[model samples]
Target: MDNRKEILDELSGLSPRLRDLKAKGDGLTTPEGYFEGLSDQVWSRLKDSPKKETVVRPMRRLWRLPYKSGIAAALVLAAAALIWLNRPRESAAFDLGALTPQEAEQYILNNIEDFDLSMLVASRPEEIADPAGAGRTDTLDSELDQLLDEYLEDVDDATLEQILF
Candidate 1:
């Protein structure tokens, strides 16, 4: 007990305010009705503080531009259409009806190599329906026919069917 008293005397000598607070039991005293008006004190301080200036940023532009390639394509198509509509008309100077049967045959014979035989046959379908099916063909048409005939004469029907079917 004497040792504890000596320690307390040393502490009191160091700080008189601490010794006085110890005598008073507790030094944490508040103003009257502090707890009752706590909410009002907080609100009053909040209202008195300086307000922040709001930033007024402008809205960014939308990416709603029309397609450049699409516009160019439309323009190109319009130009092509206009040119096609206003094109020069072909003259009927060389009438097909003015051609004689012999002259036409001579012209065809002269340019037989140039003409596509399949296209010719397709054009003259009525010529396909010959009397007795006796097809009148020139050297150009009969060349392949003659070769085929010689080939068939050599190969038997069974071999021909195997190759064909």
Candidate 2:
């Protein structure tokens, strides 16, 4: 409350001086009709000034040449890569005439498990016999013996024993 009273007293002391200053308004003043003629003055100045032409040239279209070619090259490379990656490889051809006796024997031995020996042996005799079954057993036996001898010539005793057993 005391602070409010002191503020009121100070404002009262300055009241007369504030009234005198207010009666003699600030000396700053604009010329008569300054605002009304501002737009017209600006227009007259602009009309008397010389005008300069502004020309805008179009940009060159060659800037994207390298980028376009690079994309085309990338696409071509990608296509080539895909074609190379997906191409079929030629399989190695097996030549019986080119194989050595040992190679042939090894191949036969390795693939022996693929044959069904029991089924072959159990086949009907009629299948083995020709239209005439009489007096042909000797010839067949001799041919079989010859073939067996030739096949067993290169085979070791142990392998033969294993096959026989």
lDDT of candidate 1 over 1-165, digit per residue (tens): 897677569878898677656656665889999899999999999899977777545332222245556667888999999999899853222321254756545544444445445755444444456644436434325743454465567768897686656
The window of 10 residues in a row where model 2 has the poorest summed lDDT is 115-124
lDDT of 2 by residue, 64-107 (tens): 67667877888899999999989985221233235575664454
Measured against the true structure, the TM-scores of the candidates, in listed sequence, are: 0.24, 0.22
List candidate 2 stretches off by more than 4 Å: 1-124, 127-131
Which predicted model would earn the best TM-score? Answer: 1
Native-referenced Cα lDDT, model 1: 0.58
RMSD of each: 28.4, 27.3
Candidate 2 lDDT at 81 equals 100
TM-score of 2: 0.22
Q: What's the CA error at residue 154 for candidate 2, in Å?
A: 2.0
